[model samples]
Target: MPMRRLRPRPALPSRRKAAATVVAAALVGGAFVGILSLTGTPHAPSARAAEGTGAGEHVRAKALPADAHGKSGKPGRPVRGVRPPVSVVQIVAHPDDDLFFMNPDVSQSLHSGNPLTGVYLTAGESDGVNARPRDAKAAAPDKAGYAEARQNGIRAAYAEMATGSRTSPWDRSAIPTKGGGWAELDTLRARPQIRLVWLQLREAGSVNGDRPYSLHGLWNGRIGVLASQRAAGTPVPTDFAYTKEQVVATLTGILERFRPTFVRMQDPSPGTYPKTGRFRDHQDHLYGARFVQSALARYAELPGHPHVGVQNYLGYPTSVLPHTLDPETADAKLRTVKTYAWLDGVHDCGTDAGCGDLKVAARPGGRGWTQTVRYARGTSTSWVQRDRDGGLHAFSVLDGRLAAWRKPADAVAWRGPELLPGGGLDSGVTSVTLPDGRIAVFGTRTTLGDSATDYRREVVTTVQDEPGGGFGPWLSLGTPEPDDASGTSDISAPAVTVAPDGLATVVLRDSRHRLTAREQRTDGDWDPWRPLGGTDVYGDPVAATDAEGRGYVFASTPKTVLAWAAQSPGEPLAGPAATGLPPTTLALSASAAPDGEGVRLWFRKPASGDLRSADFSGTGPVSPVTELPGTGVAGYGPVSGGDGLVAVRSRTGFLATAPHGRSGSRPVWTLEKFLFSGAPDAGTDGVAAIGLDARLHWTPAGR
Candidate 1:
């Protein structure tokens, strides 16, 4: 295809002006950022802005009566109900990374008609061979041509997703990056809301091999400035090199320009086998994600940008895990890949370099990528809690800090997602309510230091000093692994449960896939970390308390679920007994049974979205599993249950819910068509989720 004429660079808008315009548009439209109904309608903002404080202001918690039930008396500063418009910015290592790992999501966001931008860090010119080995007539190695072909494929795929046709034209232009380089920018003409940015940096030829000039080398300080590889027929006029600081600055520039409400990237710490010393994902994916992480840290420090929620997607490692998508969803995902791979081998795109990456034509799906989508972090379902006064409080990590949202028992609308004070908190936050009604929130925090080796992750928690009161300072709970190098900071999000005596126990799966925990003493001191005896454990562990006040914890392996239950109230947990269950999709949730018989464990069957549950009274054998009637909306993730209600992610990437105990009868699932981060949390009066727009959305009971 002939390259489109480059458009003149437009004057950039100031950050403050841009931010104000977004907020005004959203408020005038009566909708929160990034939220859309099933019919693509925007829901009205549920609450008016607080009178005195700004929307992002921090509200000081006031103390309530010791025995108060969910009442916070009078709100200090209500959370700002009006939020800025929502936009998404995704950064990946290569052209097809978003399609392989972040899709269904990418496609769904496009359907929502929100502003979405994808940024590619490198020119994926691998071996310069655009065809499979069997195609002898394929052209000789032309790195520039291969890169251009890949770009064409990506454009076609995204166009088909945004508009209805793959032939939709795009407006091509060049933009100056903060990293002191020029990047090619393509905007879909049919739907101006969608865009693609190409940095055109050099990619490592080998996936796992030692490439001294690659992103991995630069990240590890083995190289200075990595040179760029401009694609053939690109709009960029000249090539450039980027040092570590420059690369981060470039990404930070993109974030500032877009001011996205949600940011997506690959997993920085995909983990490695200690014995084999093999990384779980491609080196470029890992190192590139690290650069994005650093850029996000820098972006968070700058003012005027909207608060953003971060989601890290699992990359190549999803191949080894069981398929998370059903046939229908998987097939849809495969169709997009086929378009990107130019599987039909048609030259319809008019590109002499070939329409797409023909090398992927032989296996368009690429391992098991198209069949599954898994999150590397932020899968915790314990983020929502009911306080003593029967009010609801929901928590999520936004801009590397704890964001709290509350709904009073007497109020019709929710309030305050007012962010807490500190930062560096990672995704996947969990919480537990103490006997006295105080709630404690837990999460892992990433500490980035001067050197790459200084990167570290450790558990930290903050608790309300009294019911409905201000939270105390964050307390650090050191990691079980000795350091970041050994563990790659691959610890699971903390699963905590408060005992009847008011003590708390935090459980987590260590880097070696073993369960370890710490117990709180009467004097408010914590016990040293101790192993809980389990191997091959994967995913985050869950903790729950039964009617008898006993605490139960469960973690899943590829084959079965393992359990660790307290022998008595206020005591250490016992054996990691086998649950004798079948393989699961690695997502687990727990809640007390309605009958008060035992702690009920909820999970999905392997390769299917069917929900199943079994009651565990103690460490003894669990009750026979019971399958819930399918809502016909297949999805993979933890299911949150409370007050006889359950909330799950539906196949359409929306929140779906059904009441518990409708066995034999098909329950009507109330589906909400908004894409959200982390897991949905269910409470007595409502279901809550953190929307991609970085705001908390609550669905009242019976809605």
Candidate 2:
């Protein structure tokens, strides 16, 4: 027996008249055009949804709020530099998940002035109840309306971040998603640089070992036994008919269009819940993550698809774990901890859409909101490369400059010979091969006076060429002269990237810390530094050039790996384009390698304790690429350079590689450890390993 279908909603008086007029005209024009649209075009609805497009008949009409737009219709700011070579696309199960977990990267990309997009899989509708602050006039604010509340909350949050105003109005329009569901999307909030893609699927209840039935169990095929019952009086409908493939297709369609360079999703593992032996994370979060993994597999098979970087964020159960933040910016974010935790007035109202959903007001004295720290604060790390032969050099403040290693098979493995420069190695040291083949290193330095507070700011550069690759001397590059000193004060280490033009551009994240660029002439002449007007990125920034000779910058804060590029030559780089990053304590290191006709970014994710790669091939953003695990802390070369095959040291002393421009699961080469520079010898064969003696083992490609 065929299942009975629901009746279609009656058209409004005016719409009915309009349809009649259209039908009359169509009849006069004949059936050819009608047949084409009905059978071949995307305009045709599926047989089951022929009448109402799957959302069902009598669709509830919620007057969408005003469309949010900046004066121009574009979202966000225009990227100043040549368009970025790497694209990034971030995907998450719910709205605000990126901000809460993959942020700094998301925010960083917007500032990178690059093309980026965010895709939310679910409407993130929680309990549907919008809670109000206790101090409000109305004690019991409302009983139900969680979905609307979440919508309001997310829109407010997005509007605030995009347009620089939380009060920005949103114009909502229903866009049909795969499986016939409708997504009410928000239009431009900031500038048009950023776009919000929402697939308004229902949210699953958190399985805190409490809920008997949930969306998680239903999606996994447990059906009635593990599913939540529907509310009797609610008009909002629920369906458990979607298959795993249908859900993946919904996401796949979004990816096909965006082609992001990065995709951030919640941790699928959800780790183990401390209190309950079961997975601590909500079942939805886990399943959603697995669904994403499936989509990635499909995406990887697509021709000309962008290289995507995937970042897994810690979830609710892992919230209590130690985490890290951009040292300099941690305080500013910490200020909002109270607001995120408590039911403050800030999250109370939804000026445009009503209160947003997702999270509910915390119970009295409950575990309030808190920032997750990945690593200990103020732990400084750097990637030092030998200019002599482009070998890898890594330095950390782990035990102060006392830890220095050199590459040599004879040296003892894993043992450090602290090479404390007479004046202490400056913070943020990066290596660059000079036109003359000499290795140049740059970092920030401060001159101490008699008093602890007495100090002067300065930028310093050094040169090294030899077996030990010891620095020759420090040449002062003058002060960046920043405007703010909230707590810490020091000019950032200059970010150096040898452009395709052979001219070296030294960029710095300044004290008030704007990004400034200076060029080192191939003739050895230095240009006066100029401000690039992007947000201050808080870590060691790396730069690379695309096939078109466009300059790009890749940097890391405690939260993300960000890329910047100019729209064209002589223009400032775009605001930061995000590397879909999770909150990690990774001392990030990045290098660009040839990708077919362009360049791709090979990065190390310290948080995951492995090396990974991604490329930007589209106009939107990069996609997430699965990391090839094996290399450990020793296998890492935190700072890596070279093309074709690249080299990086893992903390565990193993070297690994993902062939240039290739995707899918492939085996990686793990090089044997030989003590060289307290680490492994960096290589160009795309393989290198680190040892205790600092001596690096290098293997030429194919040799």
The local distance difference test score of each candidate is 0.74, 0.42
Query: Could you tell me every candidate's TM-score relative to the true structure?
Result: 0.87, 0.41
Per-residue lDDT, model 2, residue 316, is 59
Over 4 Å off, model 2 = 1-87, 132-144, 210-215, 224-241, 273-276, 326-328, 334-353, 356-370, 373-703
Top-TM-score candidate index: 1
Give the range where candidate 1 is weakest over 10 consecutive residues by summed lDDT.
14-23
> At residue 349, what lDDT does model 1 achieve?
75
lDDT (tens digit, per residue) of candidate 1 on 373-403: 8888888877877776767777888788887
Clashing pairs in 1: 1-350, 1-351, 69-388, 69-389, 69-390, 70-388, 70-389, 70-390, 71-389, 79-416
TM-score of 2: 0.41
Cα displacement (Å) at residue 116, model 1:
1.0
Model 1, 530: alpha-carbon shift in Å? 2.2
